[model samples]
Target: MGDETTHIEQAGPTELRDPLVRTEIKRAAVWIGMTLAVLAVIVLAQPLLLILGGLVFASILDGGTRLLGRVLPIGRGWRLAIVTLAAVAFIVGTIWLAGVQLSGQAAAFSATVTAQANSMLAWAGTHGFTPGEVQMDQIGQQLMGGLGRLTSAVSSALGAITSLFMIMIIGLFIAVEPRLYERGVAWMLPLRSRDRFYRTTSRMGYTLRRLMAGRLIGMAVEGVGTWFLLWLGGVPMAALLGLLTGILAFLPNIGAIISGVLIILVGFSAGVDAGLWAIAVYVIVQMVDGYLIVPYVARKTVDLAPALVLGAQLLFGALFGILGLALADPIIAMAKAALQQNADERSGGKAAAEP
Candidate 1:
């Protein structure tokens, strides 16, 4: 009985020694590892996203620092400090100057939007829409509830000041000595992979820098242009609209839609002429951005498809909320750069191996 038990144990190892059995075991291990990885990602999604946000913020700061370096001819640290301080000063000054105006306008803007929405619903009802009063009430309630949930979730995840502070600190540290972190990450990888990893990362960084530069330029142009044109046309809440437009411009398709809707609603609240002017301003601004800014930027950076970016934005927004929405483009651009680098490497290797 003892010998039989020993034989059975030995048989297992003997089977494992066979090439086919070994391959099967390896496959099973891979599957198990992948499943575990997925589970871990699900559990740690928030922390992972925050880290990614930090990286994105770091990239923006790094980009500015590099740009400043060209003209300033100063140390990177000093340049970075100047850039950071300038950003802080701008925010503080803006708030100090227009805090009260913005606060009042924000409240009025909310009321105007609500009134316009009700007006539209009434107009639709007059056109003989089929929905009953109960259904309409339920829809309105559901929409408000959904918005409440979304806002609450975003606030909790962001933790407002705390999350912002953490992200800024993380960004500052990484920006201060990015190479240290890079090397640290590379050290954890297999020796053979370090070179490829470095190469891929280099590509990703270059793409990100270029992409962010274009986006910054686009935001500035759209924001400033919209503000000036709307103000010239005597549009109400020009400053608020401009600020919102500029911030939203950071987001792409959805941002434009949202800002445009706000502009139109506010414009109509004033008068028909104001509304028409608002429409004209929106059209002109979008045209400039879409035709001139976007094409130029696409040429310099990764030429992402609109559909692909929108799809990613939706997916990331659903999974990770507003932060994810903000980050979707950068993440996609980096991923594309990495994939391209990998494909190039594979092609080069194949070419080298051919007779």
Candidate 2:
């Protein structure tokens, strides 16, 4: 036993642990660290995701450009141009349509409110409640105060627009040079390790792309369905409601609830019967979305527990405002996938015990 112990000691740490083992340990540690960093990035670099999203969008545009570029195949030089043109067309079209519709709706809404206010004032006058220009001036002051809020809202909206523009610029750059980035990253890694690193990143990118595409399609369907239904029912603010429904669909369960509340509010304002009918429509639509739409569209999407998603949202919301809320689902989904992978690895790991 003493001889064996001496021999073992003499063999030293190098024999006890292979260099590859050490390398793999280092790799795994780094991999885990990178995973954590990604989570941190999601939390911290959310604004960047908008840029990333834009870049992803640009990359999609690049695909189309590449198709045409092949004959005379322009380099990615035309990428930014193509993306910018497409974006301009989309934005201009959306704005033109939205502006016309919103303006007409807003005018009608304002007129209705004005008529109501005038009727109330006249009734008060007939009731011998004579509050004259002084009351009108007080009301006007209140209106002016609300206008101040609009100024802030406009400023906020402008900031959002600027942020989106920056995102698009950043996205265009990233999309154009995605391979450059991969090559750069791989260059730093050892030859054998390079393939693994590239594979990991490629996997992530492919998965995210597929997931986002599916999610966007699902949202579009939900939006179209909701809008058509609301319009059929002659619901007030059908256009706005449809937009809201589509946007909210990305959020899952909470989105349905939010849409329902909006429908109820619109219904209530329209009158008791309209409101009841509207609520019925929203509930039915929600049921269809939950049971039918989610099962098929989100089929390959994250299959997480409802409780977990909701809990994550609450937990994230408490730490950060809306950014955390926005990230909660994606974050949770990634975590769940990681955990499942780890479990599988452990189950398949080399062991002394026989199965």
Candidate 3:
């Protein structure tokens, strides 16, 4: 041998292992494979797995309430109960109000369609269009055909309900489980990175609370303001539509666009005047959410660019439909946080050595 010999070091600060060294490669491989396997299983069982996925965030939510209660000067449980009950009441009330509006508007729309069939056919004919009868006949057939598939999809939806219940149970368990997941994660992390994972998991509950608070507040503000605008415009079903818009708005950019499109379509169906009002309602709400509500409410929430958020929505939506669309933001935020934390650790070490 020459004057020196090489020594193996542990993996890079952020990666599973150092590619240049071989000592821990098998360990890293096993871990990586295991993680991928679990993800594959999740993807395969997504309809069922979705609920479990939700539990991850719910744990964050309920976890936050506990923290808030702790920080408050009074009994912790009392504060949490009051806040939770208020949230439940608000949701129930919004649903009830919107349901009433939906029934009224839906009934009116159905009647209008039946009574105006001949007139609509005549209008289509004058516009150099195919006869309205042919179009309606085709559409009616498609809708009826779709009913079967929709009914079949209901099974997945029922599974969804079960999933939601599962998430709730899992979340409650996680919130009280003495950070078992955290300890497990820490065990796998490199010696140097161990402390950070533990610390992050300790605060995971708080992170969830903060995220939920921002999300709920932003949504609430957007929802109320939107309903007021729709109501003022004398838009049909404004209350119900606003609630739908608000709920969908939870998903950020893509959600807003979807709700806007639906509002516009519904508006058009209501006639030119209603259509115009609906468009205005959507535009005003977007402005409010984009400029005022989102900026103010999400101030401390993850500061993701709208474009990035939308991109994630597109990618996730393609793979997982509405569920992915709903979760894209927080999932992306969590990823961003993890990356930044790793980068900071590396940079800090480099900077310390430079001086």
Candidate 4:
């Protein structure tokens, strides 16, 4: 018995294995596994990005179904089918109408862009801010090189028709049965937590719907308004620029800057007066969106922080290209909602009181 007691003393505390050593080992293993998983995701980011794109489309369809239900008294299936058909028809009509004009103006657009760039360079030279044609040449080379890289990256990852088909199919399936997927996810959670999970998902859906509505309204307003004003102002490539602006408008801050720059540049290519008119048109369109459309939509949904959205855009853009950048705001909004719910739960629903 004395020997056994001595042996026990020498053995020390195996209890530490359960409370400390085992826990530490488990933690280390989890961290390592997470790191590997993240690395794998980064490597396979293209497919993941495609999946995310499908989710965005699904959200749009889901939102449309809900909206149509309010007015049409139709089943989800009929509503979804109607919305999808209408969307397809709209796209086809737009393309058919613009196809000839866009093709014809393509060369003129390129020439105008080049002229504006050279003019900008010359202006910079006159201001003593540029070293003349050498700097201009360098800038052109850099721009071309960057574009080449971007094109290569995009083509390599998403050039396949198969990818687009896959994305569309995924989105169609998800939209067809959003509730099934939502319930499945909730079912995976503990029974006590499932309500919270469902609530979070519903909140996220509402937020996304509002966000997308705002985006679509902004895009339509900007595109139509810009096209009309630019055409009236006799700016070259009015249709193309307007279409570009409308699509880019979906990206918020960065989109505005890009569209503004393109408009100003193309406007300048025509004349100084045209440039001023383009600026005026831009200001008017943006003012209307800012004061009217955005406020109305924001009242219905969560207002995202500009910096957070921009950061997500940059990070996602680097990882997954244009699709990531385009979807960044919605993704961030959804994530923010989820995180807020988690925080509220962790704080015993007292987080709502703190600030």
Winning model by TM-score: 1
Clashes of each: 0, 2, 0, 0
Model 1 C-alpha lDDT per residue in residues 1-355, reported as the tens digit of each score: 3455433444455586778789888999999999999999867766777788788778888989998988999899999999888766765565554566698888888788777766766777777773533333556677445432333335663474465666777888888999999999999999999988888888888788788888888899988999999999999989888988988998989889889988898888899999999999999999999999999988877899999999898887776667777889999999998888888898885111100
**What is the alpha-carbon lDDT for the whole of candidate 2?**
0.61
By TM-score rank, best first, the candidates go: 1, 4, 3, 2
TM-score (all chains, Cα) for each model = 0.87, 0.60, 0.68, 0.85
Whichever of 3 and 4 has more TM-score, that candidate is: 4
User: Runs in model 4 with CA error above 4 Å?
Assistant: 1-21, 92-100, 131-153, 156-165, 345-355
Pairs clashing in candidate 4? none
Any idea how many clashes model 4 has? 0
lDDT of 3 by residue, 154-214 (tens): 2474765565555655655554444575677688889987866654443434444566666
Candidate 2 local Cα displacement, residue 81, angstroms: 7.7
Q: Which has the greatest lDDT?
A: 1
**TM-score of candidate 3 relative to the true fold:** 0.68
Error of 4 at 47 (Å): 1.7
- Candidate 1 positional error at 90, Å: 3.6
Global lDDT of each model? 0.81, 0.61, 0.62, 0.78
